[model samples]
Target: KEYNVAILGATGAVGTRLMQKLAESNIPVKSLKLLASKRSAGKKLKYRDDVLTVEEATPDSFDGVDLVLASAGGAVSKKLLPEAVKRGAVAVDNTSAFRMDPDVPLVVPEVNPDALENHHGIIANPNCSTIQMVVALEPIRKQFGLKQIIVSTYQAASGAGQSGLDELRDEAQEHLDGKKMDAHIFPVKGEKEHYPLAFNLLPQIDVFEKDGYTHEEWKMIHETKKIMLNDMNSGAIKVTATCVRVPVEICHGESVYFTVDDAKDASREKIQSILNDAPGVTLKDDPKKQLYPQPIDAAGKEDTYVGRVRPDQENDNAYNMWVVADNLLKGAALNTVEIGEELVKRDLI
Candidate 1:
């Protein structure tokens, strides 16, 4: 069936990539609509030989659209998604606005395509960092049973949206000229302070809460639990995270340590064998050749890359792995698109 698709926040980084993916998608499209803030209205966006003008996203934008892919910020999503759904469009949102809502299914198709079956006209894309890690680990959890997960992320600036990328570039140039760099975006922009992300690592991603964990770190923890649907009484997965922003520009890389509740005989090779064939996952480990997943290599890719698999020395049932993916693709656009595809496949749309 052909779909009339509308892309909200069409001018932003993830929104732009969402348009590109839709253009290249195998799904049949009857019409493509681009909607953004008033500041980006009337901007022309090229898609498959067609030039679509960006319209201000409003209640009327979803009048005839069948599928709405929303990559707009949270406030915009909070205000617009219900309108799209009310207008009979299924919204695949790439924001945190409704992800934790009990009614909205927080989905990563590779990990939980079944969640799409229950969508009430809206499906949420998991966080960029959370999506890739869950894609790599879900298969293992299915086969071996996950018990705990501890992750330290080396995230790219792109995860912060376009302004983050601009900040990294401008800061690097300023440093090269031996001048003090200005930071108005990285870590958190609206917060009282900002810090340079050029040739440096910031331990924070979003604002710090009274609980001491930054919002990004909390997102990783809570979102992981929600996506994995860990049964509390059954000793489901325990997740903890420390999210950091590094100098990278595209992909987010994670160092993950996890333990399974399986027999102690499970070996690293066994885990590697399981991940090697998992869906939406690419295993690229070869220590002998100094080969492993890297951000540059993972940029623009759709699959989550996993490598550096080994057993943790202190824990008998624990293992270590590294996961990486383009923060804008599998992390955002591709995952949203995947959710839309699942809706179609399951006759949920």
Candidate 2:
């Protein structure tokens, strides 16, 4: 089956990657529509030897489109996602806008493609950090009932979009040349203060709420539960996160510690064996050879990589592992395409 597809925010980091993946995806495309802001309307992007022009997005953009892959931003998705649906397109949004909306399905194809069955014309892709974590954890959660998850994310600058990456690059060159460092991005662009994000750790990804946890941290906490169990207070699992923006250019890494509700049956070796065969996951643990997943190795890869498996000495039920994946691929773009493909596979579209 073929369909007309439109990509909102087609010129941004995730948006650009989404366009690239569409060319390689199995979903047949009758036509491709690229929508960006007014300033990016005339910009051209290449796909399968076709240099497609990006147009300004509006409610009418999705008029003839059967599918909408939105990566613009949270505010933009909140405003136009429903409009796209109203115009007869099922929007798979890569934002936090409708993730917790109750009506919209927060989905990760490999982890919860079933959530897409009852889509209200809009499906939200989980946060980049949350997406990779759950992809690595879903197998474990299924084999052994999950109890709690505590993850510390090493997020990439790309999570903030291309502007965040630009700032990191400029800061790095200036700092190395011993020039005065300029700070305008990272942490939060609109915040009262900005901090350097090169050769340094900010320990914060977004603005801090009254509770001291940043928005990025909260997304990981809430979105994980919603995608994994479809409920925040489902008591199915408890999740916590400390999101930090590192100087890395691409991909995100997480040091995750999880407690199994039934560890007796799912030991460390048992969990590792499950992950080895888990879908969308690539196990890379080999402690003797000092082998494990790394951001540099995971960047540009489509699969979520898991390694550094170990049992926590403090608790027999608790174990730790490292997870990594290209933030743009599995975390955002490729996952959106995967959802669209899944929908197509089931003739849901």
Candidate 3:
């Protein structure tokens, strides 16, 4: 069966990778449409040997599209994803826009492909940090039963989009040249303060809410539960996050501390063995050889790398792990494409 696919935000970082992943995917594609804003419209992008022109996205763009892979932004997704669905396209959105909406199913193909069956035309891709963390823990959760999760994320500059990557590069050169560094997009672009992310780490990703957690952190906490828990209202699994923007250009590194329900059966070796066999996960834990996943090694990869698995000294039921993945790939683009493939496999689209 062939499907017509449209990519919203086609010219952006995640959108660009979505196109690449789709080309590499097995989903039968009868047609491909690239949709972006007016500024990127008329521009051309290469798909294998075929050059596709970018069209300005509108309600009419989804007229015959069977599937839509979207990552434009929250506002863009909010504005157009419904239009796509109205026109009969099932959208896999890589944005925070429809994520928390009860009607929309937030899914990670590895953790919860079954969630795709409940989709009402829109499937939200979880936050990049949350995506990798859940993928690393899901196998453990399935085996030992998850109880809690506390994650500290070392997010990349690319999380802010292409402008953030450009800013990081320019700032690095400026700092080395002894010139005053200029900041415009890090630590939240809309915030009054913009700090250089070249040699510094910002504790904030999105705006802070009344509870003092940044919106990104809040998303991690709630989105984790939404994806992992059987009930959204269940406080069964506690999840908290501290999201920080690091100087890395790509890939996100996370130190995840978690506790399992089955303390008697959950051992470091047992967890490692389970992860090794889990789908979409690559186990890299070996402390003797000093082997573990690294951001550089995980960059551009699809699998979530898990390493440094150890039982917590204070709590037998608790454990710690290091997880890494390409934020643009597994976290955003690849996951979105995988969702599309799952839909095809299930005949859901």
Query: What TM-scores do the predictions have?
Result: 0.97, 0.98, 0.98
What's the number of clashes in each of the models?
A: 0, 0, 0
Q: lDDT tens string, model 3, 1-349?
A: 9999999999999999999999999899999999999999899999988999999999999999999999999999999999999999999999999898888889988888888888899999999999999899888888889888889999999998998999999999999999999998888888999999999999999999999999999888888888888455579998888999999999999999999996457788889999999998999988899999998899988899999999899986999999999999998999999989999999999
Model 3: what TM-score? 0.98
Q: Relative to the true structure, how large is the alpha-carbon lDDT of every model?
A: 0.89, 0.90, 0.92
Which segments of candidate 3 are over 4 A away from where they belong? Answer: none
lDDT of candidate 2 vs native?
A: 0.90
Give the per-residue lDDT digits (tens) of candidate 2, residues 1-349: 7999999999999998998899999999999999999999899899888999999999888898999999998899989888988888888999888888888999898888898888889988888999999999998888888899999999999989999999999999999999977999877889898889998999988788799999888888888888887895566788888988999999999999999985357677898899999999999999999889999999999999999988899887899999999999999999999999998998887
lDDT of model 2 at position 218: 86
Error of 3 at 344 (Å): 0.6
Off by over 4 Å in 1: 230-235
Clashes of 1: 0
| All-Cα superposition RMSD per candidate | 1.4, 1.1, 1.0
Question: What lDDT tens digits, residue by residue, belong to model 1 across residues 221-244?
Answer: 888888888321233677889999
Candidate 3 lDDT score at position 28: 97
Give the TM-score comparing model 2 with the true structure, all chains together. 0.98
Off by over 4 Å in 2: none
